[model samples]
Target chain A: MNDFEYLEPATVAEACAMLKRYGGEARPYAGGAYLSIVMKQGLIRPKALVNIKKIQELKGIRFDPSEGFVIGALATHRELETSQLIREKLPILCAVEREVANIRVRNVGTVGGNLASGEPLTDLAQVFLALDARVAISGPSGDRTIPLEELFVDLYQTSLGEEEILTRVIVPPPPPATGIEYIRFSSSSVVDKPCVGVAVRISLNADRKTCGTVRIALGCVAPRPMRAQGAEALLTGHPLSPQLVEQAAAAAAEECSPISDLRGSERFKRGIVRVLVRRAMAVAYDRASHASTLRLRSGQAGSA
Target chain B: MKKQIRLRVNGMDRTVEVAPRTSLLEAVRDQLGLTGAKLGCDMQVCGACTLLLDGKPVSACSFLAVDADGSELTTIEGLAAGDRLHPLQEAFMDCGALQCGYCTSGFILTAKALLDEQPRPSEEQIKDYLGGNFCRCGCYQEIIQAVKKVAGI
Candidate 1:
C-alpha cells in the first residue's frame, strides 16, 4: 500500500466534487479489497482515495414488484446472499453469491465495486446481464442508467468515467412463470477462475410445456459477458424439447470465443459451456413449469 | 505523510500517528504493541489477519490504519474476560483444534462471528462460514467439533 491521502466524504455530492477536483489522480474506495490488491501489484497508483462507505445514498436494497429491484452500490455480496427478497425473487443470484470467494470476502465485497472493476470472472456481471439489469452511475454532470451489457467495454475496463461513481443497480423483475439458473465450471476446488459460466432465465407458457421468452448470458468465455442471442432465439416461443435444448447449447458453445488461459483450454471451456448451458436450461425449465404451483401454494398458505 | 488516527482496539481507545498506507495489522502489532492479530499474507488471501471491524470480520492486513478512525475493533486478545478464556478458546484447547497454532487467532475470530450469529449452525454451514480461513495443519475436523461442542449441539 503506497502512501496516499484519504478523504472520507460524507455525501455523494462531496465525493463527486473530490473526484472532479482530483480528476484521475483520485480513486473512489468501496470495500478496498480489489483496489488494495491492485495497488500493491502496481496496476493502479492514485494520489488520493475518496472513501465512500460513509455515503448513505450508496447503501441498502429495495425491491418493488411493480418498479423492480434496486440494489445500492455499497451493498455487500453477503447482504445480497442473505436478503429475503433476493432469495425469494431471484434464487439463482443466491446460488452464484454463495460461490463468490467466501464469507469473509463476501462480507466486504460490494456489488458496485465488483461490477465497476469489470473483472471477467465476476459472477454478478453475468447474472445481471442475463436479467437485463441497469447500472445507475453518478458523474460530475449527473446520474445516468447504462444497461449492463453496455457498461463493460472490455476486460478490467468499463464505461465509467474518472469522476463517475456507480450508485445502484436496477434489475427488472422477471415476468410471472419465469425461472432462472446459473451454472459454472471452476478450475480449482475453490472456484478461483471460472472456465465458463452460464446464466439462463426463461418464462414458460400457460400449459407450462413451452417457453414464452428466454435470456441467456455467458461469462469468462468472451472479452465481456456475451448474450447467446442465437441460442436464446431458438428457445424463445418454442417447446423446450431435449433435442432443441441440445441444439441451443451447441449454438451457445459455437458462438463463444474463449481463449486458453490458466483456468482451462479454449476447447475445454467450450465443452463446459455446452454442458452448463444444457443443464442450466433444464433447471430453468423445471422452475418455470413449477412456478405456478409454487405461487398458488404460497398464496393459499398466506391466506390460511 | 503520517496522519493521526484514533482507534478503539479491544476495549481501550488509543491514538497513534502512522504513515497513510500502514495496514491496521501493522498498527495493532507494531505501533500499539498488540500482536494477537497475526499477519500471514499481506494480501487478503490468507485469513491470518482477520479481526472484527464494528462486529464484522474483515482482513486487517488489507485495511488502512486511517480507516479505523472512530471505529470499534476487536482482536483475539479481547475474546477472553479477565483471567478466564472465552468459551471458544477453551473449546479449541479441549478439542485440540490447533496444530502449530499459526492460524488459531484468525480462525477463532471468524468462528466467534459465526457462533455469535448462529448459536447452533449445521455442520455444512460451519464449513461454509469458515471457508475463507485456511488451516494448513488440517485441524478443521477438530475445530468443527470444538465449535459444535461450544454451541451445545
Candidate 2:
C-alpha cells in the first residue's frame, strides 16, 4: 500500500470538515475490508485515510415495528447477523448476511463499506433495493436520505459525493401479512462468486392465498441491483398459482441484461435468476401464510 | 514515518517504535520475537496470521501495528498455560489435526475464538467459522473433530 496520512477524527463534524478540506484527497475508512484491498491493488491513491471506525454515532442496530430499522454504517456483518431486532423484523437480511465472506471478514466488513464500494455481487444491495431501503449521507451540507434506487449510478459508482460519508441504512419493516426471502446461485459448491441473487417481499391477502403486493429485486445480473417491475406487476393482487409464478419468473429473466463473465455466461445467469426468483417467491409466500395463520390463531385464543 | 506503539500481548505490555506501514504480523514476529503467527499470504486471504484483537480473531497481515495501540492482543503463544496446553491445543494434538503444522497456530486461535463464543457448536457451524482460516493439508475432518472434542459435543 502507498504511504498515506492517517487522521482519527473524534466526531462526525470534524470528519466532515476534514473531508471538505481535503476533498477527493481524503477517503473515510470504515471496516477497511474493500478499501484496504483496493489500496493494496493500487486501484486508488488517496492522500489521506480518515479512520471513522471510532465514531460512536455510526455503530449499532436498532429497530421497531412501528419505526422501522436503523442500521449504523459502521455496524459489522457479524453484528447484523446476530442482531435480535434484525432477526425478528427483517429475517431475510440475516439470511443474506450469513453468506457474506466469512466469520473474520464479517467481523470487520461494515455495511457502509460494502455499499460504498458499490460491488454488483454484494448481497445487501439486492435486499435493500427490494425493500426500498434508504441510504443516509452526512457531509458539510448536513444529512440527507437518498432512496436506494437513486444511490447506485453504475457499476462501482454511487451518488455519494467525494466528501460525503454514508451514515446509516434505514430498512422499513414489511407491511402486515408480508414475507421476504433472498436466494442466490454461486459458481461452485462454495459461494465464491454469486451468479444471480433474487430478493422477494410479498404481502398476502386475508385468506393468505393471494398476493396483495409484491416486490422483486435482482442482483449480479445487472449494472446495478434493480427491481423486476414487470414481474412484480404480474403478481400483485393475483393469486400465486404455479402458472402465474412461472410466468413472473420468465418475465424477470427476460428483463435482466447480464454480461458474460468468468463466473458464467449471460444466458446462464439469466436462467439462474428465473429459477431463483420462483424459489424465493415460493418460500416467501409460505412464510407469509404461516405467519398469518399464527396471528389468527393467537387472536382467537385471546378472544376466548 | 515511524511511530511508537504499545501492544499488550499475552497479558504483557510491550512498547516499540516502527515504520508507519509495518503490519501487526511483522511487529509480532520481527520486533517482539514472537514468531508463532506465520506469514503465509501476507494478505487477508490466508488465515496464517490470525490472532485475537480484543477477543475477536482478525488477520494480522491486514491490520496495522499502530492501530493496535493499547489494545488487548492474544497470539498463539498465549494459548498455553505454562506447562499445560490449552484445551483446543491438547485436542488438536490428540486428534492428529496438524500435518505440516505451518497453519497450526492460526487454526488453533480461530478455533479458540469459536469455542469460546459457542462452546458446543454443531459441525456445520464450526466449518462456517473456520471458512476464513484455510488448511492446505486437507486435515479439516480431523480439525473439525478436534474442535468438537474440546467443545464436548
Candidate 3:
C-alpha cells in the first residue's frame, strides 16, 4: 500500500481522461474490496487511482423493457442482493449473491469491479454468462459493448485496455419459460471462495417438454469462467432426460481444467463440478417447466 | 499524497489526513482514537475490522479511509449512550455472547447493522448475516441468543 494520488472524477469522460493521462500508471478505484487486498500485498501499485465512485452514470440498476437489466458498474453486491428490479426479473441472481463473500464485502464490492478484476474464484461471471451478460467500457477511443466472457482474459487479467473503464453490465431479460440456476461448491467454510461453481440456464419451447436454448457456465475450474460448450451442445434443442442430463454432466466434468489448491484437489473439483452441473441443470429444467407457477413471489424474493 | 477527508464518526464530525493507501481501520484507530475496530486478518475474510458506513457493515481494514469521505461511520464505541448500553450490547452481556473479546466489536457492529435492517430476522438469516465473523472461542450459541433476545424472537 504505497502512497499514490487519488483522483475522483464525477463523470465517465473525465474518468477516462484521467486514466488516459496516467496510462498504465492509473487504475479505476471502485469499492476497493478486492483491489485493496491485492494492492496491500504489493501486487499492483498504480501511480494514481481514478476513483470512479462519484460518477453518476455508473451507479444505478435499471430495467429496460427491451434490453432487460442495465446494471450500473458501481451497483454494490448488497444493492443487487436487495434490488426489487433484480428480484423481479432475475431472482436467481439474488439467491446466488446472498452467498457471495459476506455482508461486509457485499456492502461495498461492486459488480463491475468484481468482473473487471478478472478473479476466477467468482460466482457472478458464471451466473452472468448463463444469462448472456455483456459489459460496456469507456476509453480514449470511445465506448464499446462486449460480451462479459470476452472481457475475461486470464488470471486477474481482462481484455480491457489500460485506459478502458468498464461502465455497465447489461443482462438481457431471460426469455419466457427460461430458467437459470447457479450453484457454488465451497470446499471448506461457507465464506471460503468457491471450489467449483456451475451455472445452468435452460429455455424450454412452447411445448415445455424440450430445451430450446441451453447454457452451461462453469467457474473456479479454469483461469476464467467459461461456457461448457460441449456439455451445452448435448442439451440444446433436445429433451432433458435423466440419461441426457447425466451425459451432459459427465461431459462438463471432463471439459473443465481445474488445478489443485487450498479449496480442493483437481479431481475433487471435477467431481464437484459434475455434481453441481447436474444438480443445477435439473433445478433449472424444473423451473423452466413451471416458470409461470414457480416464480418466487415478490414477498419471498425480498426475504433473502 | 495525503488527503483530508471528513467523516461523521460515532455521530461526531471529524477530519483526518490520510494517504491513499491508509486503511479505514488505521485512520479510525490512529487519528480518530476510536479503536474498537481491530485489524484481525487484514484480509476481508475476518470481520474484526467491521464498521458501519452509512449503516451498512464494511470491512474497514480493506476499505480505503479516504473513500469514507462524507459518510457516517459507526463503530462499537457508538452503540452506547453516555453510560447506558445499547439494547444489543445489553443482550450480549446478558447472554454471555463473548469470551476472549477479540472478535466482539466486529460481531456486535455487524449484528447491530443486521438488527437495524431486519428487526425480526429468522434464525437462518442471523447465521447467514453473521457467518463472516469468526469466533475462536466458539461463543456462537450465545451470540445467536443475544441477537434473538434483542429481536424478541
TM-score to true structure, per model: 0.94, 0.93, 0.97
Query: Model 3: runs farther than 4 Å from truth?
Result: A293-304
Q: Candidate 1's residue-wise lDDT over A1-304, tens digit each?
A: 5678888899988998999898788999988878888887888889999999999989999886665899999999989988887777676677788878767778788999999987887677888887889999998899898898888889889999999999999998776787777877777756265667788878887767788878889999988888999999998778889999999999999998999988889998898889888988887887787886432111100000
User: lDDT (CA) for every model shown?
Assistant: 0.84, 0.82, 0.89
Question: Relative to the unseen true structure, what is the C-alpha lDDT of residue B100 in candidate 2, on a scale of 0 to 100?
Answer: 93
Interface RMSD per candidate: 1.6, 1.8, 0.8
lDDT-based ranking: 3, 1, 2
For this target, which candidate reaches the highest TM-score against the unseen true structure? 3
The per-residue C-alpha lDDT of model 1 at residue A17 equals 93
Better of 2 and 3 by TM-score: 3
DockQ for every prediction shown: 0.69, 0.54, 0.90
In order of listing, the candidates' clash counts read 0, 0, 0
Every prediction: chain A TM-score:
0.92, 0.92, 0.96
On residues A50-116, what C-alpha lDDT tens digit does candidate 2 reach at each position?
Answer: 8888899998899745546899999998898888877666767777888777676787789988898
Candidate 1 backbone collisions, by pair? none
- Stretches off by above 4 angstroms in model 2 are A64-67, A189-191, A205-209, A293-304, B18-20
Candidate number with greatest lDDT = 3
Candidate 3 lDDT, A1-304, residue by residue in tens: 8778999999999998998898799999999988898889999989999999999999999988777689999999989999988887778888888989999999999999999999999898998999899999999899999999899999999999998899999998777888778888777898988888888999898888889889999999999999999999999889889999999999999998999999889998888888888888888888888788435322121100
